[model samples]
Target: MTDSADTLRARLTEAGRVCGGWCTVHIDFSEDRENPEGLAESRRRSVRDRLNRMGADDATVAAIEDALSTPSGLPSPFSRFLLARDGEVAVDEAVPGAARGETLEVGVLPRLAPLIATGVDEFPYLVVRTSRDGGDVAVHRTGAFFPESTASVEGRTDTLHKVKGGGWAQLNQQEHVEELWKQNQQELSAEVDRLVREVRPRLLVVSGDVKARRLLLDAVGQAARSIAVELDANTRSDGTDAARLDAFVAEQVAAVEQRDRADALDLLRSRVSQERAAADVGLREVVGALQQAQVDTLFVDVAALDGETLLALDGVPWVARPGDETGDAEAVGEVPAAEAILRAALLTDARILTATQQATGAGAAALLRWPAASVTGA
Candidate 1:
């Protein structure tokens, strides 16, 4: 429900590390067509039984139920993710996508890879559906959990008409109408500039009345203009073809993600080829860098870690192979490899980029702030 990334970061970072006694739930609470009310109860009962078997206390179960019952901020057909520790809801999210399936795990490090896969947003965009006088702006925030925010600019209809059948007197009224249009465009442009600054969206999608589109684009600052894109699917002044607008937005966002993903991969390969060790591939090296907070971004292939297990320590670099935990950690336990690595990445403030198993051979890799040799003493 919260719009702030800082809030989620602060809550998770506060945990530092916890090996067990945590309940992580990722499930679809979207309205069930067959039996909406019953589905909710069924999902809850299934989780409650599992957690009870795992020795979850009453508070933990209550916290989980409260989060599930709460309404989501995200649009419909989205899944809900809740992470609870010490009888408190630590992380709660409404991810915008169809649920793959239900996942309920307890006594493990929070299963965060799925959360990252679904909740993480990178390519922010703004869709401006404009008209002669003003327009509606849908702002997609950068790297946001809840991505949708809205604003609108409506101009007075009194002087919206252009030149009509008239004499010189009416010609003066036409001039007034043109002036009003310019004024409205300017006002809308100023608001767009403000939103661009606040959201820092990667794309400014402009649509609607062609004339207003041009005028608003012209009125906006140079920076917004640079990224502004014009779309032609305007059904009417008051509304747009929703499906077409949605598809275009999806296409634009996908293109950006593909470009960025390629750029990241290329950079990793180049750093490795050049022998900078600025990039570390596989678990041992990446985990080593992460321990010291050296990772700038962590690339993880969740498929590679599917059904895999890892040992976790209480603090400092937090991960170890099974049977290796006894050396340092005062508290240690076995947890999902994907969860442990992702948790470490988040705690160290490293950005996570989910990769396919084909791209990353191991469960994890990292682009580091410093050379790996420094950490490994090679």
Candidate 2:
């Protein structure tokens, strides 16, 4: 029921706490261009059949179908995600990292680990292809089905062509043209600056003329320049090399995530050495910390949770492992380890981070809100 991005994770996991189970789905609309709708229904029907075989109740099956019934009309190369309970959906929207095929799950918790592992950014961003005359900008946001906005920032066009000869007059004209290019960049950058402030984009990607990019860097003020990454592209709308541009975009995006992970790992290492450390290492330990609503950040390889289950109880101290409990929390059966951890993290408002590299020897780690000993005075 929450609409704020700040509390989305919490909203998702709150449903997990009271819901008996979930029906999760990720359907890629682009994989079958010929019959996208049909493909989606086929996949849904398969899950429908499976659920029916399992003797799932009518309400749960209907909830799953109703959730999946809404199709995203976004363009190709996009995917959608849905998570439903007995008769209501908690999460339903478009997302990045298009699955190669239909992925459906009926489980103990909402299947959100795979999506989180895709490094979904929760903020808006701008991608621009600029030239000396103007820039083409596309605004993108997390879970947005398509580019949220687009703008063409054009300035004076008369000064774009450069002079080739070397006479005093030509040299003067060349200087004039260079100055005009700067003016054009200033105009484009001003629009970009406005957009950045309005949307508070997490990053800005500018690609086009080298000279224009330099001018943009100079003109854009601190806020925009701080997150701007100049792509080595010589495109300006027309005749854009689609393949090359996609490759560059993917590479830059991956690089940004890598830098973020590096910083997190460094902090994790530094914190772990302290006497009253606010960090937990290993999947089991992290899960234990999550039960206390103590996790501030979680680091893990999503792959590690595959085919693995975690011991959990139905109520307080929701997570546990063998030889690790002594209370009256009733057993809730084995739950998917990844979903359990993800659910706990979400419920407790913890940041879920996919550790692309090794975080610890145990395939998972977390920076807790407090030291382990402080949690429930264990």
Candidate 3:
């Protein structure tokens, strides 16, 4: 089974109960300059160094070492190494999707809650380029790229001769040629709509014949046009500049990410002003809403995940103040507030959106599935 955010959350919750040590390691496999053997060895050494710095117990360290020594036998572009031991609770698996950069994390529980929240950062997008007669389309997700679908439309090839360059016959033939081009555009537009519905990409990038592109755009629905990013560069079905295409896609992806973040923040601000129950701002309110499975979309500052702590009271997480006396007061120590909230969101199957500090000044906020009662009452 895939190691999704839900599975990771369940594993962490189960592992948290076990009385033992845990180690989490994240390695970037984006470097293609080195050979496979050398890269694996380097990653292993890096994990060992991180473990050594933590001064982990012998059994825990041995388990991690053994797990790392054995290959997964599957092609994994990214790496997330997790190991825990408490009478047989060992989590050793390589996560499939990760962005570029080295992220090494080790803690008593899997320090992967934040990663789950940021999963959307790797969501796929569709790229389509139309040609004179046909077009090529591809899907890009995470670090993987694959062709999704293709389209083709035939147009008039023969040239019509004019009678002394002024004849109704020549004009009629020109209109016929234009009609064929319109038909081609219509066919491509229908295909685009189908692909968008199936893939639900975060962005749609289109580049190719200008007239065809315009006609297709006009034919496509508003939803498709809303997310579409038109490229002015020349492209064809058989030949394409790989480097230039990659750069263009990367730039569009960054722009889409920025827009998404800004939109989430804008919604948060709007909701806060209205004092709407469906939107929550600040840590305490957001945590409470999450615990109730009321959150629809959670917007959290990346820095906030490591800034605050939450106490687990009778296995239920809560954001308690210094002298607050709630429940049995039987504290189960403290866990990262971000992790606790993330765990709750996963359990409820809510969407998680990571925002910048400037966007989420209160550390965390959430859009609820339904209106929640006042936090004071809860």
**Index of the highest-TM-score prediction:** 1
Off by over 4 Å in 3: 1-23, 34-36, 48-108, 113-118, 121-124, 140-180, 275-277, 304-307, 312-333, 370-378
Question: Which candidate ranks first by lDDT, i.e. highest?
Answer: 1
Q: What are the models' TM-scores?
A: 0.87, 0.79, 0.69
In model 2, the runs with Cα more than 4 Å from the true position are 1-11, 27-41, 56-80, 86-88, 93-103, 120-123, 142-145, 163-176, 198-200, 302-333, 356-358, 375-378
How does candidate 2 fare on TM-score?
A: 0.79
Give a tens-digit lDDT track for model 3, residues 1-378: 233333444565555443225565555543344587677678777776777788665566666656666655544455544645532324544555554445554544555453454353356677877754545666666433344344554544454222345578877876776666666667777777887888688888988878768877888888789889888766765555655766788799878877876787787777766744578888888877866667888887756556688754434333344455655535544677876666556556677777765676677889877766654434
The digit string of per-residue lDDT tens for model 1 on 105-222 reads 7765676766777535445688888888778887774435344778888887786887668799899999889888878888889989998898788888888877888889989998
Candidate 1: the clashing residue pairs are none
lDDT (Cα, tens digit) per residue for candidate 2, span 121-205: 4657788888888777888765554467899878888857788988899998888898889898888888899998898887788
Q: Enumerate clash totals for all models, in the order shown.
A: 0, 0, 0
Name the regions of candidate 1 deviating beyond 4 angstroms: 1-12, 15-20, 73-75, 119-124, 142-149, 164-173, 235-237, 322-331, 375-378
Worst 10 residues of 2 by lDDT: 1-10
Alpha-carbon deviation at 298 in model 2, angstroms: 1.3
Ranking by TM-score: 1, 2, 3
